[model samples]
Target: MEILDHLDKLKIFIAVAQRGSISAASQELALTQPAITRAIQTLENAAGYPLFTRNRSGMQLTQGGQILFETAGRVLKEVSDATLRGAHVRTEMAGTFTIGTYESLAEYLWPDFLLKVQKDYPLINLSIRTDSQRSHLEELNNGTLDLLVDAEPRHRQNLAMWPLYTDRFSFYATKAATELNPETAKNLTLLYVRNAFDEDNVTIESHLKSAGYQFQQEYTFDSFTTVKRMAEKGLGIAVLPQRLADKEGKLKLIKAKGFKEGFGHHGIFATVSPHRENDRRIKTVVNLLRKQLS
Candidate 1:
């Protein structure tokens, strides 16, 4: 006989043995008396021996029934304990959290946020990936990222985005160019990161156009690192995220008059799949970023 098939029989047998009466066990289990009697019969048949001695007043467990009672009680307790432990483990924020970010924020913001998370939740194994804004959204849709940090995109579907912070784009140049004002901004040689500003993707190009200014010498690069380095070497005034520009500490912020009036700042946001927004571990990390980076 298979032990698994007889588990219900064992449970009823244990209940009957402990209660000392079939009717009493039936009441305790909310089972009909006939059902209880049938379960006891099944237990006896499986055991190949009489389990309970029935009498007018009550029932008594035979030697085999007594042995099963002891074993079943322990088994039930162990199973229940295992279930509770499993539940506890599920509640802990101890799992992989994969986050995707753009190059600038990944370089500027994530280092301090990571330190705080490690100190608080050491068990949250973290993985960070840097991608362009468009690529980040693609990976997020394909389920490759658990959380995302980037400039606010124009469209969001099946995703929840929360505003984290705003970063302004500013012109940075060598100390010699600090004397160059907004009226002459068009005269300065300018370094541009091609991916950083596009007419459809970012507002910088339109803002610069409205100011009646244009770069006299234009150098375009693919990466912000290159843009900043070239600007530091005094090749041109580079327009980059104010935070990233500040971090370089090598260039001076050249504030043009009326420059602050045009598309000055863009919002940065934290995004997650709609279903995972409320998850404890994901929420914890998002909250940590909002708190630390705000």
Candidate 2:
């Protein structure tokens, strides 16, 4: 017969021999008992020997059957592994997915997200890069980032944006700065994210101007972690998302009237390339984030 016939009969023979009963092999293969027996009979005839001896003890493999069964088991296992490998290559689950985000959010969320992703989708490798909002958006546009998690969405025509969560901005300072009076606090300097301008530069500028507050710009940094660290060290007061500040016990919130309206900003958003909007992996991640964070 053909090579396929040999392979199929060998599989059937192994199944029956391992199961020790033709009826059990047929049940496992979703075939009738007669069909399973006939397949084994055909295999034994092709090899010119009896593969198994039937008795009350079910079925026992003859000498020839033992050799074929051992060889076939390994071959089937290799074929199964190769089939799984080929399937992985054809799907998006096995490759690396690059994610971009701001440093602060990355610090807050990346650890937990990485843990969950690893536990659930172990095959999907994740690479996270932390940068400023502007740089993150640039990477998204350049196709260097498969996904972007940011506080604001880029207004590009070729990007798809989805809201993830909203967080409020609050004023925070070290315990030392908390003792400063309002007038003194105004001059204590303010640690603001340089990239906040990308969100609403004009509004912030106008608000600062109206408040007659001129911050010492000498210690400004592009990194959010640096901003938080400086603020914790009592270097200056800072305007940060309330969630981040609240999580740090060393910092205390400074509630001023009208501060919320001026400083409050948009929440987290997921940005994907227009071309990758329908990509299965991206869609799966977006959906999972929405379900988890929403």
Candidate 3:
């Protein structure tokens, strides 16, 4: 007989062994007493040996029944454990989530979102790593990161993305440097983040190139924080996301006439493997991010 055919019989056998009576087992299992007896008989026929002996007081287990009872008890315990584990995962009750994002987003966007996640999922341990967009995407593909936030979404068959928020880019410098015109400013030291360049960078570069002004790159940093620090220290004028510039409060937004189109807006996106798209933890994080962005 198929193993599946013996499952119901095994269940009844276990129940009777636990309750020590067919009547009690039947009530516990929500089956009629006769039905429980029939199930026990089916198990005996399958095993080629009787599992229980009936007495005036109740049913008692035979030697073979005792062995099967122990085995069944272990199996039932495993089944219960598996059920609970699945429920916990579905509810996002526990697990560690590794998140990756570019430096700019990590600095500007993740503070509040991290606090909210901690409040909502006390059991979920979050590990965050900040890197360049390209490196973040590579880590995500290699399973090092469960999710990634980047200025631009990666184009890959196994990855999915969604827009988080859009922010404009702007040119900024310290108030002491306000007297420098855009042309003269290009001749001064200019700090740039090579890895964090997005579509906005392209627009800004083109506008500057067309204006016959070329910036003399004095320093190149891999992080936005470094570039912002350099600009605030009066080391150079830099192009920065408007939100960061506004938050810093140390830099003044340049109001040059032709530079308006240079402030391109970018949509932040979440990147993750398609296989993990339906994971409860990932879905919860995505929902929270969407809410924060909205």
Which number leads on TM-score? 1
RMSD of each: 21.2, 20.0, 19.2
CA deviation > 4 Å runs, candidate 3: 1-90, 132-135, 176-182, 194-196, 200-204
Q: Estimate the lDDT of model 3.
A: 0.71
Q: What do the candidate models score in CA lDDT, each in turn?
A: 0.72, 0.70, 0.71
Give per-candidate clash totals.
Answer: 0, 0, 0
Which segments of model 2 are wrong by more than 4 Å? 1-94, 132-142, 176-182, 198-205, 215-218, 260-262, 291-294
lDDT per residue (tens digit) for residues 95-160 in model 3: 667788766667767888889888987766677887656666645654557788777564667688
Q: Candidate 1 residues 231-276, lDDT tens each?
A: 8888888888787888858888876655653245667888987766
Tell me each candidate's TM-score.
Answer: 0.63, 0.60, 0.62
User: What is candidate 2's lDDT per residue for 22-114, written digit by digit as tens?
Assistant: 888888789998888878778877788888999998999898777776567545644654465566886556555788887778776777778
